[model samples]
Target: MKINKLLILAALPMIGLTANAQDKGPQKNDFTVAATVSYNNTVMQNAAVGTLPSYNGFQAQSTNWNDKSLQVGIEGGWFFLDEWKLVLGGGMSITKHPGYSGVPGSADSDESFEWGDVPSYGAVADQNFVQFNVYTGVDRYFKTKVDGLYLYAGARVGYAYGRNISFTDDEYNMGKSVGEAFNVRGALTGGVEYYITDGLFVGAQVDPFAYTYNRSLIKPQEGLSNLDANSHNYSILAAPTIKIGFKF
Candidate 1:
């Protein structure tokens, strides 16, 4: 009888442990890593207005676009708290612009000039840009009705360095540094994710506001020498991204 009672006591503890494990539910995942690709058609734009001494009372306006910028990056996060995560990421971007042609002349005048008019003179006639950025942020995830669906809000601070080079010909080696900039920015981010499987998911995110300070360095050109290398310029911008991730 005593041996049977001892066996009962041992089995009772095992049963209690199983019941406790069931009541606690499945373990939550605490870490995630992701890769993202983003595109921005109008990352930057600028317009300039001026008057030329040769054209009496004439005003000229010029516009520029930094179109079709592409970025690829990776991000990783640790959920230190139940619903809060610490995130870090880094990326590189490339932007290209169409080649520039000299301003068209009036139909009445036969005098027209190309950008390569002067010997040994070069203009950033066609530009290509490359940039790198790194950031750290905090994210909060919310519970949702559907299993494997997640939503998050985050904020990040980052620094970026970029350069734009102009090439004289199709060979990119014949190029000169036309412009460069260093920037620091802070952003507010929000996103949604849906996990197709327990460990993999797809998502999209947007930065509604990014406050930035930019310091620019640009080469001098004919008739336009007003660029300041030590100026403090501020801008507000937004960025959107699509990503795929894995959680473990």
Candidate 2:
């Protein structure tokens, strides 16, 4: 009977310690607000068509690198259940392409074709792209040995608005237009964060896959007709992001 009593006493302290740990665990009511930046370097292929001879009846592909764009955004989330959160975010991005210029019939004519009979004829073409996106997602956190370290996995859906402007210096004035588009995409993500204090943290995240549906309107150039196009794209490998945030 004495040994049984000692065993019971030992178990009581362990039970108390477990209860104390639970009482000190992270709260479900915590709210977090964060800022994020991301870069993607993968090249994407885009299709183009137009009523002009240069564009008519020809199947052509344009290539652009996703990493050439820069993104900045803000996100906010509330933990409604232990280790589970619902988040909403918005961001903007800018992308650019630099084109080459060369003179025709001169020593500088190596890169560009001569237009008409002008000996000094030269051409330079470039594009600027802009985009804005809004998204929402749910994440579940996994606890780590470090008190403030967190790891999570989530899925997100977003709507985006985009525009592209192409500029060219040529006698025929080709490759100038304002193209606008809208798209929706879904992504799967994983992230890790480290809290610098009880209320401040820094993190990083990556999206492995993102599928998009897009619709675009290409404005008429000079005398050309307006072109409307729809496309579906899959980003098998998306972007990785850096994030910082505060919790309350």
Question: What lDDT score belongs to each candidate, Candidate 1 first?
Answer: 0.59, 0.68
Which candidate leads the pack in lDDT? Answer: 2
Compute the lDDT for candidate 2: 0.68
Q: What is the lDDT, from 0 to 100, of the residue 193 in candidate 1?
A: 81
**Clashes within 3 Å, all models in order:** 0, 1
> Candidate 1, residues 149-238: lDDT per residue as tens digits?
778898988776766665444232233335556656677888888876656779898876666565654543334543434333232335
What is the model-wide C-alpha lDDT for candidate 1? 0.59
Best TM-score among the predictions, by candidate number? 2
**Candidate 1 clashes between residue pairs 3 or more apart in a chain or in different chains:** none
In the range 47-148, model 2's lDDT, one tens digit per residue, is 221223354442211112262476566789999988999999776778898865646564345455455534654465577778777889999898888667
Which pairs, if any, clash in model 2?
A: 40-67
